[model samples]
Target: MKPLLLIILYCAAVTLPLLASWLVGGPPRPFRHELASGLGILAFSMILMEFVLSGRFKKISTGIGMDVTMRVHQMMARTALIFAMLHPFLYRGTASGGQRPWDPTRQLTITTDFYDLSSGITAFLLLPCLVLLAVGRTKLDYKYETWRLMHGIGATLIAALLLHHTVYAGRYGSQPVMTWLWLVMTGLAIVSLIYVYLVAPLRETARPWRVTSVTRLTPGQWEVTVAPEKHPGLDFKAGQFVWLNVGHSAFSLKENPFSICSAPAAGSKISFMIKELGDFTRTVGQIKPGTIAYLDGPYGSLTVDGRNEPGIALIAGGVGIAPLLGILRELRQTGDPRKVKLIYGNRTDNQIAFRDELDEEDVTYVVSEPTAAWQGEKGFIDPALIDRVFSPLEIKEWLFVMCGPGIMMDIVEDHLITRGTPSRHILSERFDYD
Candidate 1:
């Protein structure tokens, strides 16, 4: 279905303008050309975003699936950039191939035309920015904040340049139908981009949460809660996260995404149970409240609504429990009666973030390292434990949502697949960001 849609969209993008012009009985007008280019660029840009943006597609795609999608999006972005570069080149104010309207590529090549040069320079600049971003993301391992700023600015510049190129060269502003379509589509794309980049980041900056408290649960483990400045309702679903601006102010581009352990109903307040995992996250404990902070999120679709299963099975290892807490809190609020079984793994009972909270849920604790008088399920979540707890019917009907370390989710997924459970039934979220 998706492949068919892609083909149809591509065909329409390439042929629709020519067909419309032919119908109008003349050379393809600038208005028609502009509208065509605008729509084509918009469609292609959306496809490109899905691969780069760390969101639903990243979570859903099984390993090799992401690789394929990324490659395709990369190629499409490069191609679309070329078309944007050539918008003025091929379509603007010129006679081509004996004035034949059908000759699409008559003036396609780059030349000394100023408008064409402007468009070409803009495209050339924008394309390399995207390339650098992709390279920095995949190969160079650039700083997240740096890449984010450059990417936002670069994208905005490209959009502006393209709009300028289209208006001046394609002349859509003169035709009512073409003008309206161009305006609407351009507005929509700009709105989406702004929402994703500008508005979203600003909202995060306005969050009044200050780090009022920070507690170290154990070695390499900590929990931090920010006190709300006032009664600002932060409505967020479970299994969603808010980006945290630690050290620097929220206005800065250096924010990290973290899941809220507390439910949304908690209102005014949120808690993030985190482990001292990395360089940026390790500093999560030192952040002082009364300082500005930003939270841009509540993103992800690992909720219960989409599942057709009878019940849910939640598997959490260490800090991966963050999103699960959101889910569990949501379940508690709604008075959901669906049977839920949570298998939480930790080094020991003391190392667990929300030990008491897990006990309240329909959950079992697995302690990897036992100290003193403690006896419960131990070791990693192996297949034997899974078989012992869930029957064949239950396995088939139950929805498995796992969020934790990559290896843990991988093992659990493989085990579920080894049984009769289909791949779709088992869902996992990656807590690790590259």
Candidate 2:
């Protein structure tokens, strides 16, 4: 459905722009150039919408479509950036030219009249686009919030400048009807960006949650609880995640989605047990109690959304147990009679962060290492161990929710695949780095 919508929108945007240019007596070169740019922008928008609508709902771990979609979006954005920058450069010496690219260097030593002011101002925004592409993925040392804000501002500046230039100087966009169409298309892109930024954050703030307590769960792990002050905002089913913002300081800029660890109806605070693995997680320990935190959704398709199988089997490793805890707590709250078996792995018994919580829950624990007086299942979870525990008949009727280390999920997925389990039957999530 999303692909169909994208195709329709792309054709309309391209055809309308070309027809409008022809009707306005626009030159052949400018019309062809602007049409190409419009198509690129349309392609970029379609890829973005497709990811938002369908990428998150996919059950399989890997697919060719997912890879292609990501690649298309990235390439189209780069292409649009180049074309936008070059549009003014081609019109440098023309009477309609506003600013020259070389104006900045010339103004360094003395006053200049050779300035094409409009194009130069537009080119200034190119700096941000180049920087953002250079630091793409936020994989560098910069903070996530800082990078996101800068990237957003840069993209906005470019779009605004491009829109202004096209309206005033573009030959195709000079006529009233053509100008309105150009403005409308650009407006949609800006609106989409606003939805991604301003609108989404505002929606998140409406969720009811206040910081209750923070405790150290492991060497660098903190378990923070956010209970409702008055009434619960919404109950989260197991296997769903909420987008969280710590305080107003970085609220708008930094919204990291973390899986809920407590049941939605526990009458207690919602909890998130996170390891200090990154810059954002590291600062969570300093979060004071009574601080207001905004939560945006209980999103994701991994939850047991009523698949009437024989039972549910859950697997987790280390901090990945957060989502599994949500499912278990939810099951207990709803009085679900389905038998649930959990196989959780960790480096050692001591590092099993929520030991007390797991022991209290109606689930099995598979600890990898136990030094003294250890009596639980030992060693890594492999295909042989799973086969020994459950028969083929039992496996067929069981719904598997596997989360944790990516490698472990891969091994379990492969084992299930070998046993002829459909990929849709097994659900997993991992912020894995390739």
Candidate 3:
């Protein structure tokens, strides 16, 4: 689906319970009480929807790009946290007691029962912790796999807590129709989790891959190749990525996303150029050939397979060259007639990977910390470098695909917009959304 349609569906899903509660008419209550209930309903619904927004679903991630999908997920989580935090406080002035005989609809008094309120109280306390841990995950000492597992489990617990609290304590949610709505919505959320963890893994177990080679390209980078064991290789376009799990079970959480550095036309074997950064990545060189691996992707919208632009401009910074290399190789293998230029930037010359191959193309190497013998561009890949590499016509007419540090992409995007390049003409993916 397109971004607009996905957004429309999201708004409809989150607000469905709120709308159902409003439709399930009851005795009128104070405005503050109704507002509190509405906020609670929306927050619960948004929390449930976060399962589908985890960027594991191809239909959502492929449409908006994983970076945008993840950014949306983070923003929505914080918004739900804010709404959840304010839900109880808005009921301060409302009358609070057990359901009274006088108020059959429970409109005159709010529940003060310990059982009904306990879940809400616990969830209110845990919600902030979950959001804070996610926001500060990089700074924390925990491994990425550990943090991912914690995040998934914490979210599941919160969802269960919210469901109980909403059904028992909520004035509107206590109604038969509203109760069923919450039940169905929460059930769908759980099913989404099952699909991601259980169903996806079961499918991957059938189509395993084996490590073909692991070659060191630079001091901190290595090229790992994998071939399908018995099934046909992945049918993915250039510039896409996959969640690669090497020497681990299909169900293990030891997988990480890596872009395909090899062209689709390069046969069944696929390659990934990985940089030593995190716990799993630092061990890329140790992964022996023929190790069993599982792939769960072909994601991202960074490909240029069917574009009609007169030329293509590939911009890279550090390890961001992986996906762009795939695009370049596919273009060369297919004997594409469109013009191509690559601007690859790194801190030092030795840090550049695939130097022999990149040198054969129209590449401008940019090094911020160049050695004395360095001869190519000697600066960062900023707006200045972009201007020096491409002319005004090329900037406006060419298709620009970039993947790199967030700051570099931001600067380049802003400069492109200022120079008459339409937003649609510029495509990019970022490793960090924050």
* Residue range 1-434, candidate 1, lDDT tens digits: 25455456645644443344334343344564545445544533443343333332323222223323445555566666655555444445544332235554333322344764486366556666675575557455567777767766666566566555544444233244544544554565567666666666566555556666777766777777776655464666667666676656556777777778777765667778777755677776666655555565555555565566888888888887877877788777777788888888887878776666667877877888977777888887778778877888878778998887788887878888888888878766553333
Record all residue pairs in model 2 with backbone atoms less than 3 Å apart, i.e. clashing: 98-116, 98-117, 99-116, 99-117, 99-119, 227-269
Q: What is the TM-score of each candidate against the true structure?
A: 0.68, 0.70, 0.98
Which numbered prediction scores highest in lDDT against the true structure?
A: 3
* Per-residue lDDT value at 250 in model 2: 29
lDDT of 3 at 245: 95
- What are the RMSDs of all candidates, in order? 7.0, 7.4, 1.0
Scanning candidate 2 in windows of ten residues, the lowest lDDT window is 104-113
Best by TM-score: 3
Cα deviation at 320, candidate 1, in Å, is: 1.2
Q: How much does candidate 2 score in TM-score?
A: 0.70
lDDT of 3 by residue, 166-231 (tens): 888887878888888888999999999989888999999999999989999999999999999989
Q: Candidate 2, 230: how far from true, in Å? A: 4.1
Superior by lDDT: candidate 2 or candidate 3: 3
lDDT tens digits, residues 319-415, model 2? Answer: 8888888888788888988888777777777677777767875455566767777777778877876786666975777888887887898899999
